[model samples]
Target: MGWFGRKRDPQDANEMLRQYNEAEAARLAGLSSGSNLAPTTVSASFSSAEFAVEDVFTITGRGQVVTGTVASGVIRVGDRIVVLRDGADVGSSEITGIEMFRKKATEAAAGTLAGLLLRGRVDVARGDVIRTSASA
Candidate 1:
């Protein structure tokens, strides 16, 4: 847990990457062996959630509520996430709730402006990037 609430292991990231690579290779394998197919390769992975924190505040009974834009990937309520500042990992927290336009949501996707209620003690500021512990 390192001064923060939780710490992520590099192995987890490696496992996700491995799975993505295997899936991509399998998909491409079929196309290349076909009689009339352009042996094309498409790669994708649930790398992480990139959010540019725009505001940070604490709600009386809800802990810290962070409003930001999901720059990439998707974030769901109950996902474990980390706060990053200046390209360094700071702390980890779980998403307690998600809200958009005053309506509760189960998930928020890239390019959406959403507010995430985080449980745990966090010291986040504007411009910080919130990334997920696992692929989202």
Candidate 2:
């Protein structure tokens, strides 16, 4: 049976699953082969990190928190960060904490969605770019 009481074809389901598996296998192979596909994580050799801010807010006792995906490189707790808006530097602060899905982490890499707790107040907002201070 299908949704709304319509009939479902068993062959169609099997074909769809087969196609999905094939695509997944290709994706995994690309990652393992280190093809031109964008990396899922930043390597240790990466020097600079960029995070695209999607949300920003202040935590009562912990200071400001910025949530976003790491666009490139890696970010770690205790690292100094600079905020950029429209390709211009806005302000700078220190990273006090990093978290993913409520789990504490010491660092996050490219393609990772994380929240960074800042050491002090900085003028940050949505659509800003956050990067390692050294890269500023």
Candidate 3:
């Protein structure tokens, strides 16, 4: 019966998969902890951050939430930002909250996709660009 092909040991395959899972978990933990990473400091005179809106919605008690990728710079809760469309100001809003992957984040850096809760009447739309005011 064993002449057709080499017999595979079930225990060995299970052990190899377990080892792979453990290694992957360790790698994820290191990435989450940001081991050996350097801290980045944005200047006080640095102009406001920027984001491109991908989705916009309103949370009952949380207000307007705009989810998008950070196009440039950094954004933090409480930063004032302007919503623009067609090179015109639609409105301005204060960031009330910021979140990434369902976890509250203090700051969202460039290239990160984050959801921002805005406090204002700024009507946000898909494709609109959000930018921090130069004087902010």
Candidate 4:
């Protein structure tokens, strides 16, 4: 009987099976080649500091706070920073304070999840990137 009640040819079935087998063999060969399977090394240092924004809120008297992980480099209090969204510069501000787990700190390094208090109100939002100001 034909598949799905449609007429089927024996030659066509054989050809389809052969094509599938050839494709699978090629895929296996590519995987075994290991060209794309090589491990990549990542550098420990970054040229500039980058912080990914996960949350943003105002701290009333303290100013605005941006919380997230430091993607690269180091950030310190009083460092000039620029807000970026989709690779575009949104606004600039100064880091007035840094807090990790409610304890204040002078600086935050890469891979640290911290909250940074800005000196002034800059239009910032989630998914934005805070980077050390290049003009500073």
- Write down the lDDT of every candidate, Cα atoms only: 0.78, 0.80, 0.79, 0.81
**Residue 67 in model 3: shift from native, Å?**
0.4
User: Ten consecutive residues with minimal summed lDDT in candidate 4?
Assistant: 38-47
* True-vs-predicted CA distance for residue 11, candidate 2, Å: 26
lDDT per residue, candidate 3, 1-136, as tens digits?
A: 4778888657786688679868855764575576664222222334668888889998887689999878678998888888888778899989989998679998999877789999955789988888887756
In the range 46-114, model 4's lDDT, one tens digit per residue, is 456888888999977889999987877899998999888877789999999999877999999976779
Task: Give lDDT tens digits, candidate 1, residues 1-136.
Answer: 5788798656786688679868856764565567475321112246777777889998897699999777678888888988888767789889999998789999999767789999988879987888888634
Clashes of each: 0, 0, 0, 0
lDDT of 4 at 28: 45
Q: Judged by lDDT against the true structure, how good is candidate 1?
A: 0.78
Q: Return whichever of 1 and 2 wins on TM-score.
A: 2
Model 1 bad stretches (over 4 Å): 1-45
Point out where model 2 deviates above 4 Å. Answer: 1-46
Tell me each candidate's TM-score.
Answer: 0.65, 0.66, 0.66, 0.65
lDDT of 2 at 19: 92
RMSD values for the candidates in order, in angstroms, are 19.2, 8.1, 9.9, 15.7
